[model samples]
Target: MQAWRVHRNGEPGEVMRFEETGRPVPGEGQVLLRVRAANVNFPDALLCRGQYQVRPPLPFTPGVEICGETPDGRRVLATAALPDGGFAEYAVADASALLPAPASLDDAEAAALHIGYQTGWFGLHRRARLQEGETLLVHAAAGGVGSAAVQLGKAAGATVIGVVSGPGKARTAAALGCDLVVDRRTEDIVTAVKDLTGGRGADVVYDPVGGDAYAKSVKCVAFEGRIVIVGFASGVVPAPALNHALVKNYSVLGLHWGLYAAKDPAAVLACHDELSRLVAKGVVEPLVSERVALSGAADAVQRVADGATTGRIAVLPAGAGAAR
Candidate 1:
């Protein structure tokens, strides 16, 4: 078996080494999966740099989510258990946590659906309770996490405002069903949202890119609105302004989607069901921009970490069903 391993903490392209290795053995309550497609996530790079919240032991694989087939021939999506992640031809995951892959989506799309879409669903519907006809602002709206929120916001009937860095991303956001697209490089996000909402400001702000995006969201968020903090992708976690939040009467909600798997597993399953229905209806789809071969896993992770790509990148193992 061939897998990419991280021996030391550093940039993903520099630290990740592709090598021939023995297939991982599943532990008790775990199952070995033949990897079909592994989704590249920002956390993969954080894992390489030893900066993620959960640090696995040294010399670990970095992929977190995968579309794979079990020994019983069941196709499912699983959160790859650490140390032996989904970057190889085969990976292991807890049997209880595997989700049946949506029949409407291919392996790459199914792999891309788990984390990002679940986070977006929980952030918008559960935490913020975003309503129909409300103005929703999404930061980094062309990137993987933000793009999911954009599509979900539209499906929820919110007027979506997508804030992206460049023209290319702005166009992508527009195509993702955003009602309005703001390029942060050349436009003022606050003014754009305020203008689009007739000066009422955005009712909900989905922020995956913190730092500056967080700062600007506060300035334009509607009174008594909700701001969901999804992640700090900007590399700088911003200090919250409690006084401003109080004055504006808006709520600041922090979402960690992974916690639901333990605290409220049923909710996670229900969300997956809804996401699958949306996929079946073509109301939402994972924007898989690149399908890279197993050998390009390191570069894919680095590109995601650098914020140089739009939507999701799926790594297909050699001779796997989704590999082209």
Candidate 2:
């Protein structure tokens, strides 16, 4: 099997290398998957550089989410804390981690669905408890989790307002069913949310990009609104004042999707089933904007890290171009 491996902790492009390795064998209660496609995430780059919260040992593959199949021929999507060999022709995953992929979605889209969609779903539905008819604000609304949040927010019957960095990203957010798209580079996010919500402010703020975005989210959130902290993608993690939460009567909730998956597999399965049904029904679909070959794994990771790509980027192993 050919896989991209990080042999040392360093920059993405410098540490990651494509190499040949023997196919990984699955242990008991695990499945051997011929990886049809793998999704490149921001964490993949951070993982390669040993900057992510979870670090695998040296010479490990970085992809956390993948769509593939078990030895018994069941098509499934899987995620794990330990880095599996997802950036290759084959990988291994615990059978419990594998959820049946939606038959309606292609391999590329399936590969893209797990992490972002689950993160958004768990953040809004589980942590924030976002209600129907409420107004929701999504930061980094064109990125992977942001785009997913937009779609999920709409599906939950919320009036979704997306905040992006530029016009292109605004378009991407709009395509995902956001009612209003605000270009954060030019538009004031707080003012935009206020105006969009008729000065009531957003009922819920889904923030993946912390730092200024987090502070601004707090400012724009309505009384009794819930702000779900999903990730720190902006390279800065900000500590928002608790006094604001008290004064506004809102809550700042932290969502770690993997923890739920690890502690309560049944909840993970239930969420996956609901997400799969939504995908099959066309209510939610992964926007796989880029499809690259496995040999291009490093460049694909770079594209995500550099914020040059929109939606999801899938890495197709050799001879699997048509599958993507």
Best candidate (score: lDDT): 1
Tens digits of lDDT, candidate 2, 9-46: 87778888899888877788877788888888888888
lDDT of the candidates, in the order given: 0.94, 0.85
- For candidate 1, lDDT tens digit of each residue in 1-324? 999999999999999999999999999999999999999999999899999999999899989999999999988999999899999999999888899999878999999889999999999999999999899999999999999999999999999999999989989999999989999999999899888888999999999989999999999999999999998999989999799999999999999999999899899999999999999899999999999999999999999999999999999998875531
- Screening candidate 1 with a backbone cut-off below 3 angstroms (N, C-alpha, C), the clashing residue pairs are none
Whole-model alpha-carbon lDDT for candidate 1: 0.94
Give stretches of model 1 more than 4 Å off. none
Prediction 2 global C-alpha lDDT: 0.85
Clash list (residue pairs), candidate 2: none
Identify the candidate with maximal TM-score. Answer: 1
